[model samples]
Target chain A: MKGVTVLQSGGSNQMELADLSVPESGQDDLLIKVHSAAVNRTDIMTREGKAGYAVNPILGVEVAGTVVEAAGSGSFSAGDRVMGLVNGGGYAEYAVMPANRAMKIPDSISSAEAAAIPEVFLTAYQTLFWIGKLQKQEAVLIHAGASGVGTAAIQLAKQLSDAKVIVTAGSRRKLDFCRELGADILINYKEQSFDEEVLKATDGRGTDLILDFIGADYWDKNLASIKHEGRWVLIGVLGGSELSKVNLMPIMSKYIQLTGTLLTPRSDSYKAELSKDFAEVVTPYLEQGKIRPVVDSTFPVEKVHEAHQHMEDNQNIGKIILNIASAEA
Target chain B: MKGVTVLQSGGSNQMELADLSVPESGQDDLLIKVHSAAVNRTDIMTREGKAGYAVNPILGVEVAGTVVEAAGSGSFSAGDRVMGLVNGGGYAEYAVMPANRAMKIPDSISSAEAAAIPEVFLTAYQTLFWIGKLQKQEAVLIHAGASGVGTAAIQLAKQLSDAKVIVTAGSRRKLDFCRELGADILINYKEQSFDEEVLKATDGRGTDLILDFIGADYWDKNLASIKHEGRWVLIGVLGGSELSKVNLMPIMSKYIQLTGTLLTPRSDSYKAELSKDFAEVVTPYLEQGKIRPVVDSTFPVEKVHEAHQHMEDNQNIGKIILNIASAEA
Candidate 1:
């Protein structure tokens, strides 16, 4: 298998395409012939030596592929097109996906689009619906609205429920893209304060749920923008991590719940459950053309460094995809 | 009717015994001839002009007494003994309690004990079980374990589930009292660091749930002592409210949930539901003599100032009760 592997000799370095043996599919796993993979900050951080490196460190965590082999007793069969969470081997020709995590990708979307859906879409779904407990007629404020998860959250939240969706983005273009994705209210955070806008928009009640990716920079504002008994789900810390000062009094007085969540380190069974839920809820929406994957750009697997650099520079508005298969294939 | 009232002419002054007319019971309320009242920090703060002032502000929030009058459609009848949460007027000889908030007191406990149970016990019950979502066999760390809510939480958590209860207290006496109440691990915070003790006691996994009142003082330590996906329930801010510098990365990495909760200011129906749950869960324990009220000291209603002074001084081990009537009554 040709895959993206990090060179362990260097302190901080680039990912390289190298030949590797195909992984054995576990009893409850599917051997996927990966068509495409998605570039995420985790991959960049791991490559940069910021996050801990894994043994035999392969880069991508999200993939769209077809099952080449299925373990006995698993639901998936050979030649079935699937996309979902992968255990670090996604930037490869072959990857092992837990049977529970893989869901059939509808024929309506392309393989690169399917690759973009797993990590970002599932993250948006789990954070908004499962952890944030967004309800109909309630309001949600999603930070980083132009990013992959942000775009996915806006679409999923808008289509799946009657909740009012408000979004904050850095640039006007991203805000515009979020607006196209059905965000009810938009805040160009570079222009104005989101907390004030949120308060003013909601008649001082603040949003019922908040999905924040920028941790310390937006921590106080997120707290201010949350309603009494509101939920602020933290999925990423792109802005920063050290919170200067957070007055916990409001959290108690207003009954606010600040939850920190991540999709990467969850159990395989949990991912499978989320996969089942994602298929049941969002699959039909995809099939009906109510939601579409927002692909920013695609690169051949050999250009994995460029994809990581693009995401690092915050140049991509949506998912940056890596086409694993060769043009001739 | 005679009641304890704060003199509002001056800024944050004193409590005084005042003569007042009995309040009329609402359609769904019970007019009770108060036998006992519980002195709480909220009452002290209100009297000190720290919280807020109400029209004819009374100093008590919990009471146990005999029903003098029942509204047109209430379960209570004249002469029925009841204990319940009250908005105000609990310090009065006659207090009005919502029928839903009031529950019949068992014959085993005294009126003072019943009065001590409402605010503190209900706060403990709601914080530990409802907001904290404590599960069986999980570990919980309770701060201020000698205070009213702490004592109640320890007792209730012990009787209801098989959860391990770890407690932190300021003094040796308080730690001893907590141990007597079935606290498995006791950290004398005055002598050693609670975070170190908690980490050691939990075997580095930390506690599953934390009921915290020492806000800013324990903010950082609380974050350090929480397990992955643990819940930190904040009910009070006795130490301070301003958190200096908190590293939110731990919260994100550990998936910690920090919730700010309060029993006061909740809707009547919400309180009623909590009241019903409290009664259903803990009432049997009280009846079976498995749990008993830990009353620190009882002050005569006229000496309400002294009780407030004692609580403000942080000298009491458990609930400070105000005896509204003598034994002859």
Candidate 2:
């Protein structure tokens, strides 16, 4: 199997394409012949040696592929098209994961599109419904409106409930993209304070839920923009990690809830449960063309380095995918 | 009617007993002839002019009394013994509150005993069941074990679920009281780090739920002592609220949730609903004598100042009550 291996260079991550043995499939696992994989910010950090990774690390976290082999009594069969989140070993010709983590993709969705679904969609679905508990007619504020998870969260919040979805992006182009995806209010965070804008948009009541990626920079603002009994779900700390002497008085007064979560590092059973629930709820919407993938661009597997660069540059509006298989499959 | 009034002296609170007119009962209200009232820490703050209160503040929050007048079509009749949480005016000879806020007290309970039930028990019930969602076989850590809310939480957590209850208190006596109320592990926080003790008690996995009233002082330690997906419910900031540049990385990695709540300042309907729920779940335990009030001492209404001083000095083990009516009555 041909795959990308991370090499350390003066404490920096360097990627190399090399030949490696195929990973083994365990009982109750499916051996997937990966067709497409996606590049995420975490991948860039892992590659740069900033985020921790194991020895002989495989870089990709999400894959859309076909099951080449299935353990008996598994939910999937050989040759079934699937998309899923893998703990690791995704940026390769084949990857093996527990059968429950994989979801069958409909023929209507392309492999590249399916590859974009797993991490972003699952994270969005879990954050809004499972973590945020977004109710109908409640409002949600999603930061980084143009990012993969943010875009997916906006669409999910819109389609799943009658929620007023607000978004904050750095550019007008990203704001416009978010508007097309059903964002009710788009604030150019670079030009204006999102907290003030959110207050204005919601008539001073503030948002019922917030999806935050920028931690330290938005910590106080996020607190200020949340309504009574609202939830502030922290997904990423892109800006920084240290929060300075935060007064929890408002939290008590407003009865706010702050929770932090990640999709990776979860148990196989936990991932499987969320995956099953997501497939049941979102599959019909995907098949009916109500919700679709937002693939920013695609790169050949040989161009894996460039895929990491693309996400690092923060230019992509949605998922940046790596085409593992040849164009003709 | 006679009621306690807060006098401001050099920006500090001074208590005085004064003559006042009885409060009016609305169409859906109950006019209670007060028998006994409980002194909570919040009352001390409101009395000291530390916690914000409205003009002409009345101190008491919880009370047991007889229904002197029930508005037409209300739930209670004249002379019915009841106990409830009043937003204010519990210090007066008569207090008027909505009918639903008051619950009929059983004959097995004394007026002072019933007076101790509303605020602390309701807070404990709401925190453990409603916020923490404590399940069977889970573990809970209740800080300030001998305090009114802590004592109630210890009892409720033990009676409601088969949970292993751990407590952190300042003294041997407090720890003993907690143990009698069914604490599996007791850590004298004054002698050692609760986080380390909690880890040891839970075999390094940590507690599933934490009922915290001590804020900033226990903030980091509380984070360290929680298990994966554990909930830390904050009710007060007795220790302090100034948390300096705290790192939120652990919250993300452990998938922890931190929520802040207060029983006061809630809408009438919301409080009524929770009151109803508490009555439904804990009434059986109360009837079976599985749960009982831990009243520390009683002070006549004229000696209300001493009651406040007792709670302020943290000298009481459980709830301190003010007997408003004659002992024979």
For model 1, residues B1-329, the per-residue Cα lDDT tens digits are 78878766332236678878878888888899899999888887677676653444776788999998887745778998999998888888888888988988999999988988899889998998899988988899999999999999998888787779999998888999999998999998889898888999989999999999989988878988989999999898888998778787778878889898888778889999999988988888899889888899998887777787888889899889888875224
Docking class of 1: high
lDDT of 1 at B297: 94
lDDT of each residue in A1-329, candidate 1, tens digit only: 79888885342245688888888887888999999999887777667666564443788898998999898735889999999998788889999988887889999999999998999999999999999988876899999999999999999889988778899988889989998999999999989999999999899999999999999998778888998899999899888888777777778878999999888878778898999999998899999889888899999987777777788788798999999986226
DockQ of each: 0.84, 0.82
TM match of model 1 to true structure = 0.96
Score residue A235 of candidate 1 by CA lDDT.
Answer: 90
| lDDT for each candidate structure | 0.86, 0.87
lDDT of 1 at A206: 94
Count clashing residue pairs in model 2.
0
The count of residue-pair clashes in candidate 1 stands at: 2
**Clashing residue pairs in candidate 2, if any?**
none
